[model samples]
Target: MLESLSVPKRRVAAQFVLPGGSSRKVAVFLAEAVPGREGGERLSDLLNGSGPRFIPAHDAETDAMTFVHRENLALARVAAEHEPNVVDPFNLPTEHEVELRLVDGQALHGIIAYVLPEAHSRLTDYLNSAPPFFPLLEEGGQHVVLVNKHHVAYVETLRR
Candidate 1:
């Protein structure tokens, strides 16, 4: 009876970093299917979505379920493939290479690609209008760092 009413989900492994420099390995549960996507909802979507302020995940160290506060997270690291695609068939994405310095003094270097209206396509414009949690494709494109804007001290644009 319970199985019939259960929502299908998939576990995506990730590293959760707290604002104080602590880190944990966890498995984030995501819906098995979502509208407009074939595989599942990307990690970026889950972090940036307006659905909830807490993220449900399974803690590897504790071997238990845990809910992480979105605003308290410094960044969550996941495989690049698990991140949402920035490309839009109609509008080309704007790529900016940058270094994000967090409030805790940690710096992360990556490429932030986003699609914005022609009038607001600059890096500053995109950053100002981006969701609280945004995806940053790390150098080499192997991982996606979902950074919390509230924890970011500043962003420095790098020469491409």
Candidate 2:
């Protein structure tokens, strides 16, 4: 009876690469709907939000629940549909093509969007001020990579 009182959640498949280079397939449960958002709680929200230090996920292969330390994640790949719409016209958004090199020697190329003040609008300033986990929209537009700023060795700006 008590279980019915809980908010509904849906499982979204994702791939997580740990700082040590281990990759895992897991399902993250997200709320059916967020208070102000149109759809469910996004995977980005779960990773970047200040909810907890550990994220709860279900192992895809074993079906066992596991808690991963948020800080240890190198990157998380999720479907584009799982991310919230980030195109904010009011902020005068800018998209930068970039290559993020991870500490584990893997490099990913994508476009990162940012809206910053004119005086501090460079890519360096954006990266420095961005949150720990930020979204990198993949080239093909099928996936979004939530990168851990802590694991990025350096970011090379490909194009403005």
Candidate 3:
């Protein structure tokens, strides 16, 4: 019975800034590693594998979790019953369009990710943090651009 408890679950904490100036926190669980895998494999596996979970934050005053809950939930079902493949989220190049409104009164348009919630990154990785710069693909789809997160006022996902 003790063996069953050997697997470790990690608490993943994330804070996302809302469109309005408020921010919210989210917490979730992720297995530290597979039964017999290499070091740092847990995060990679969780991103590509079928299991990762969210425990909900201890302080639940608002619905800030609502904004990022979908992606978080999708990461946690655990294990692949069918195939054996792991996705390297850090390198994939798929993208989603989003609009960023800056505190300086400028609006920038671009694509935000290659993989949503990159490997080892909480699904909502960039929401509440200041970045060296958030790199993105510009709307013209020609140049790679970087935005300073400090100037980020709000974000809007422009579904295409």
**TM-score for all models, in order of appearance:** 0.93, 0.91, 0.37
lDDT of 2 at 68: 92
Q: At residue 25, what lDDT does model 3 achieve? A: 50
Model 3 agreement with the true structure over 44-100: per-residue lDDT tens digits: 243334443323343346534342332322112112221122336456644558887
- Candidate 1 ranges beyond 4 A from true positions: none
Q: What is the lDDT of residue 47 in candidate 3?
A: 32
Candidate 1 worst ten-residue window by lDDT: 80-89
RMSD of each: 1.4, 1.6, 13.2
Clashes of each: 0, 0, 3
Which residue pairs come into collision in candidate 1? none
Q: For model 1, what is the alpha-carbon lDDT of residue 108?
A: 96
Cα lDDT tens digits, model 2, 8-114, are 99999999999777899999999999887688798888998999989999999888999999889999999998885566668868788998899889989988988
Stretches of model 2 off by over 4 angstroms after superposition: none
lDDT of 2 at 93: 81
Show model 3 residue runs off by greater than 4 Å: 1-94, 116-123, 128-130
In order of lDDT, best first, we have 1, 2, 3
